[model samples]
Target: MSTQSQPSQSVLTEEESWELLAGQKIGRLATSVAGEPEIFPVSFEVSGERIFLRTKPGTKLAEVTISPRVAFEADEIGDDAAWSVVVKGRAQVLEREEDLAEARGTGLVSYLEDGKTVWIRITPSDVSGRRLVPGDQR
Candidate 1:
């Protein structure tokens, strides 16, 4: 019996990559607080060009609000398949109470151990993604 090697895709198209991010539910939000880089896995919902991550009031919250600039990323890896996307831009905490309540209702749990009652918005300046399939090699 002969078996064919699974085909691999090394690079994902911009549309394909964005679609993956949009359809996904969970991702990691990376930021710096107290001069230390921090990464927190978060449940997200994407709308248009903006990515929304909900987290409760915490140190990260204060960091994002104060810093406003950050990086957010997401990735999926398989035995032979790996993909990652990164977002570089400014992040801002929701100011309106109504928006906060609505975002919290979506059920996004953060590393802080509780869902975000206030949503953090990341307006990506640059967004890119790559995929490593079985065949194309790295």
Candidate 2:
């Protein structure tokens, strides 16, 4: 299915959905490794047109450090309902300390777990979201 959300009464407006997604501090980032989609839950924030994530030295850091293209997602769910937003983008490490600080500041506390804090940023080429409600099941 297309990533973009189909318009409906149960669905939130694109702007509303994006705003919700962007405000959240965590999501699943999907990337390809050896032809398989690798997805991981991560803490992140929307900074301008880019989404910034912080990771320690690990697969997440290693994967994007090698390949820049990546996908990001953030969603919120409730009883019998949910909304999700997807972002197709290019990923990179935030090199500057100022940018890193600003990106980290976006969330309550730090976005990273206790460890060596490494910054990863994704510049989105496409943004999409969808919402599911009770009537959609019919």
| Best TM-score among the predictions, by candidate number | 2
In candidate 1, stretches whose alpha carbon ends up further than 4 angstroms from where it belongs are 1-9, 97-115, 136-138
For model 2, what is the error of residue 71's alpha carbon versus the real structure, in angstroms, after optimal superposition? 0.9
lDDT by residue for model 2 over 38-137, one digit each (tens)?
A: 8988877676667777788888888887777898888877776778888898998888888778777766345555785777878888887787764443
User: What C-alpha lDDT do the candidate models reach, one value each?
Assistant: 0.76, 0.76
The ten-residue window of minimal lDDT in model 1 covers: 107-116
What is the C-alpha local distance difference test score of candidate 1?
0.76
How far out, in Å, is residue 102 in model 1?
A: 8.1
Q: Candidate 1 residues 49-126, lDDT tens each?
A: 678887777877877887787888888878877888888899878879876665666555454555546678787888
